[model samples]
Target: MMLDRKGNNPLLAIKFFGEGIRWLGNSKLRKFVVIPVLVNLVLYAVAFALGYLYLGDMIDRLIPDWLQWLRWILWPLFFIGFFIGGFFTFTVLANLIASPFYGMLSAATLGIAAGESATVMEVPWLRVVKAELRRAAYLGVRAILLVIISIIPGINVIAPLLWALFGAWGMALEYLAYPLENAGILFSEQRKLIGSVRWGALSFGGLAAAGLAVPIVNIVVAPAAVIGATLYLREIEKK
Candidate 1:
């Protein structure tokens, strides 16, 4: 059941979306959806509040004397803090919303590794939180390293692109890790599973990530993408 490692399977992208739609039917979408939206609202509020508290004074002091006249130029940088804060907050929240479904998806994805039919079942919140925290800690460290790289003058120009890449990979890993664990695979085994089909996972994940970047649209898209990622794992196993 180990997937073919040599090529990308484009059809999986379509299947991913279709499966996502199907998975959404399992829920009272209104009930599941409301929590994520509220989580998002809380995230935004926290982001804004932190920005005003921390950045407001920092920007005032940090704005150079000569650049004081160009306060507008420094304005956007102040908001970067908000985005950074929101990024981690959203990841935690998205995983929380999708947690109930993750075990079912994981069962399918990991069943391939186990050479068996995986039962679809509900995942407990504690399990989801534990799994996500493990993966998130790894990605958070990598993101910090990427931030350091961006501080370098010559490299800073490509920082945006690098961060985007990291974000995409992080999302894919986060999504995949849940299912892999449910199937009783450890982190190392899950890494191997994904490593074999990295391109397909990354490309499909990047597409799903488009939803994460949007505002209101992201609320629906986030859980959908997790489902998509789950389906993506199932399809990849067939290859």
Candidate 2:
């Protein structure tokens, strides 16, 4: 079912998000989620290990001996910090590496949504890898630009709000990229289309950004986003 009639409705975003999760319950889609999850897990493991082995020592040394009791709060605080950092750092990195899988995953989802047999054709593995690498490079460049923007002097103050807005926008774009690209939609066209239902897209993307901040659930964001964005796209198409 489609969400409410209102284009600006954040609640509609939530409903669409729910449909995405339900879409994932299909056994077929579960296979598409595996490699992405593995990539997430491996990166999280390495990050956590480094954080504990090195960063933990630095934090411990920063604390005074007289305030040993502070360990109670400090450890949990460190973990939270790691989690926040990981959510931002790792999700992009993992997704970048797994972009090809996500493209195929998105294609499969689109096929299923249309009630068709699989539309994906057997292509050469090298071609798939090259396309994914290009996508990863594009995203990496965009990420570097965002990082530069975040570090600027005066802009740094409002940089956080900018980051959230950009992150939400990026989340929306990444998922929608699949079907849109397939349909030959350019980035400019996608932006115009999104503007037509601005708030709904933002709400949907903002929530997707939130999902990345959480643990476990963030692992399958690729597939889930495919579902959510597909549903959201259909809504836009109907209008």
Candidate 3:
């Protein structure tokens, strides 16, 4: 049965976020989250310091005083380092945050597709990462493409929107690929599983993009967004 797409189309997505958080809480998953978060924070700090130091020197030597006006445009552009810093931080952390959730989504998707309950472990980590490496690579490549496309003059207008959607799509693909890979599905085959339902999956990610925007809330929001994407996939598969 199709879910009614009336009223709070977006609000309904939040319910999935709540459910995901609740599941994580019950699963005592915070311990798993803590290590990854700390690593992310450290990596981000290092990237920031290095970026400023390296980029500052490069900019100083590269840009002449006659082009002082360029600083106005260029300084903000230098901030792209920070954005890249944040992107790598989130890329690693997002996979970590969604690790277990990925397993559940995988098992459920497998069951839905195969008509049998799929077994998924709770303490997912490097194992899940290994299993979904291909998915992660594909997502990373796609994200890079999106970034490249967004840099073009006219395309830059839609950059922000496309970036968000790409991120969300990456998360969904990672979550969906986890269990299927563990079940011995080849990476190419797994991509097809996700690719076949690509449109619905990408839209599911658009809903999670809001959570990706918050500051303090983003820590909590990122994981919840993955959960929501998982739920969204299951819902779509039922159709």
Candidate 4:
């Protein structure tokens, strides 16, 4: 579980995620991953169903009559863009709804990672809710700004790339927040900690973003990312 503190190996993040997948098989952790997976499953299923039904209508409205000629080119791009946007958006919603379970999951993972008995620590409910709310507010404002940038002509040419990077960074913050908060790290400190290991955090979050973009694979990515972030925090603290 030891990592080179001074090394800049971003692949280590992927390795950590792999370790998370392996840990999901551990009996003690199975219960923790199940609820989140089910929650994500239902939410994502509903989202995909809605998208399937309304995506064409949405495109039609957005593209205009004169732009119908570009429908062939724009359809796939819009689909992909919506998919990625939905993935990150719903991910934040799912995490907020399941924050309590995730708090316990992070604690259990950290305890086990430290070779201690896996026990859930007593965190104040209000504190947990407030912390999650802070993260949501932070994400919400930035998302609004990103949406504005996305619609701007010419400037929006790089919107996809911007969203991709933002999504990766957001994922890193989302999962890492659990373990970091459990250890009494404030949101500001959490960002600083992740920023300290910028490449690795982005890699972990990017790999997570990619995995969660896939259908069935995404069901498990949320919990696995939680475990991976816990392990990531443990290693980072060693520095």
Q: Which candidate number has the best TM-score?
A: 4
Model 3 — which ten-residue stretch has the worst lDDT? 1-10
Q: Write the per-residue lDDT of candidate 1 for residues 1-239, one digit (tens) a residue.
A: 37665325646665675566566555333344455556666766675777687766886787877877666755676666455555667656657655655555445434433466544556666776777677777887998899899999998999999887887777767666765666566666776777677776676667656666665565566656656666566656654
Runs in model 2 lying further than 4 Å from the true structure:
1-9, 59-70, 121-161
**Backbone clashes per model, in order?**
2, 0, 0, 0
Candidate 4 residue lDDT tens string, 91-207: 878887778888888899988987898899877888877888888888778888989999999999999998888888888888888888888888988787787777888888898
Cα-based lDDT at residue 179, candidate 2: 58
Q: Write the per-residue lDDT of candidate 3 for residues 34-113, one digit (tens) a residue.
A: 54445445655666678778877877899998986887887688675566446545655556555655555445434433
RMSD of each: 5.3, 4.5, 6.5, 4.2
Model 4 superposed RMSD (Cα): 4.2
Candidate 1, residue 65: the lDDT equals 75
Query: Which candidate number has the best lDDT?
Result: 4
Q: After superposition, how far is residue 66 of candidate 2 from its true place, in Å?
A: 4.5
Better of 1 and 4 by lDDT: 4
Lowest summed lDDT across 10 adjacent residues in model 4 is found at: 1-10
Clashing pairs in 1: 4-239, 106-179
Ranked candidates, highest lDDT first: 4, 2, 1, 3
TM-scores, all models, native as reference: 0.70, 0.75, 0.58, 0.82
> For residues 1-239, what per-residue lDDT tens digits would candidate 2 score against the true structure?
12334656777767887788788877777777777778888888888898888866876788788987887887888789988777657866776677667766667777787888556633345644554455456556876877898888987788788778877876776666655555556555766666666787788888888888887778776678877777767665753
Tell me the whole-model lDDT of each prediction, alpha carbons only.
0.64, 0.71, 0.56, 0.82
